[model samples]
Target: MGLLWGITLLWAFSFSLIGVYLAGQVDAYLAVASRMALALLVFLPFWRPLPWRQALVLMATGAIEIGIMYLFLYKSYQYLTVAELLLFTIFTPLYVSLFADLFARRWPKHLWAPALLAVAGAAVIRWTELSEDYWKGFALIQAANACFAFGQVWYRHQSKSTSLTHRARFAWFFLGALLVTALASALLADWQKLPVTPVQQGVLLWLGVVASGLGYLGWSYGSTLVSAQQLAVMNNMLIPAGIVVNVVIWQGQVDWLRLGLGSVCMAGALWLCRRQSS
Candidate 1:
């Protein structure tokens, strides 16, 4: 559980860096395709190959989490600003919890407070990112968030009985599924626009190997240690709350009021998480 939270924070922050770096470079389809290919290569050796069941799950998971969700998000950047993208992302958890309830049939003991606090924090984060055109990005971002959040929980469920050794049972499924999704993306998108710069290459490397691979491993293993409700509270890391603060700090614009607001948001998240854990 501790490791899951720790890695969650790191991956959340790293995703922000990746998102900012990818700004205006390419569409989400190509971006996800390129990144997913690399991720499959990295994980290919883990398991010999995948069974039909695992392969299907991986493909389905990739379609929702990467293909449909991310591709739409990429298209969103074309229409909306970053601020709007972040705001709509806050709503994703609500969708995830709904999926969890329908599938898992319950939340943690008392999750409404932290859940509500997390929603408020999302509102504050959205407020910070608001723009006239950013609202246009809301639809895609919201879809991406819901897909990702639900996919995470579903993926966890799929791997529930598997061992967590280096020989991960899910690796082949994840890789094969990603490969198919990437291939479909290639058929649908302009593949020539890929292999752009060293920055994109490096970002894809990090996203595939570290963020998607290791971060997911952490999330999967961590979920085993924590309750679904706890996992939901921990999912707050998706918002990149800390990275926003880091950006503000880097700019040398010290606004105590905004900082205090962010701090309150963090505190609420923390308090709610603690309550869930207890």
Candidate 2:
């Protein structure tokens, strides 16, 4: 949980940094590829070969979680306002909860209420009127959300059975992500939009090394430490945390009433999950 919370705070600033510094200036595929490559470098030194099947599974999880998710997510930003993107992400907790159940081959009726509550909380913070033609953006975000949720659920379940520590085998995960993102960059990245400024370069370094590398390491491992309900609820914690960072550091506008109410709702969801675990 500490690792999870720490990474959440670390990533809270990432949204603003990307929106302010990299969104239009840098090619999204290139940024994704750069981040994955840097992250792979971080873990590569610690890599130990796993069973062929385990290695493939981790790679597949990485492909779905970060590679495909980032592809869908960055592309959707073109069609949706940042607010709309945030709003649509509220569904992620629901997806996480549902996917966990699907993977486990049984429904944990106990988890659903808190997952739905967390979604409601995030919606309160982020929901706004959608653009008339928002369906494409919505679909893209949902696909991203579903992929991310499924990946987390899959990894958590699989990690329980693996003898290798996460660090020993984690490089394979980023290698898989790099393969997808590198291919996408080769095919689709806008050459003219590559980062040219010192600020942009620095931001990418921070995002790649610290955010993508350490952040995902922490999040993936932390997901294995908690109940599925807790993990699902925790996914929504990023919404309020990111909003607060945007509001405080970036001077982004937010409705105080919604922020407060939504935060309370999120807190309640976490509390409910704690009670269930106890």
Best by TM-score: 2
The C-alpha TM-scores of every prediction are 0.81, 0.98
Cα error, candidate 1, residue 49 (Å): 4.3
Could you tell me how far off, in angstroms, the CA of residue 97 lies in candidate 2 after the best superposition? 0.6
- Please write out the lDDT profile of model 2 over residues 154-203, one tens digit for every residue: 98988878778888667999999999999999999889998999999999
Error of 1 at 9 (Å): 3.5
Give the per-residue lDDT of model 1 (tens digit) for 1-278: 68766776667556555656664565456667666666666666775655777666666875676557766677787777655666566665566566767676765346455655666765654466356665557777877788777777777776665554533544654665466566667677765566478887788778877776776666766766765556665666555445554565444233455445655774676676777567
Clashes of each: 1, 0
| Location of the lowest summed lDDT over 10 successive residues in candidate 2 | 161-170
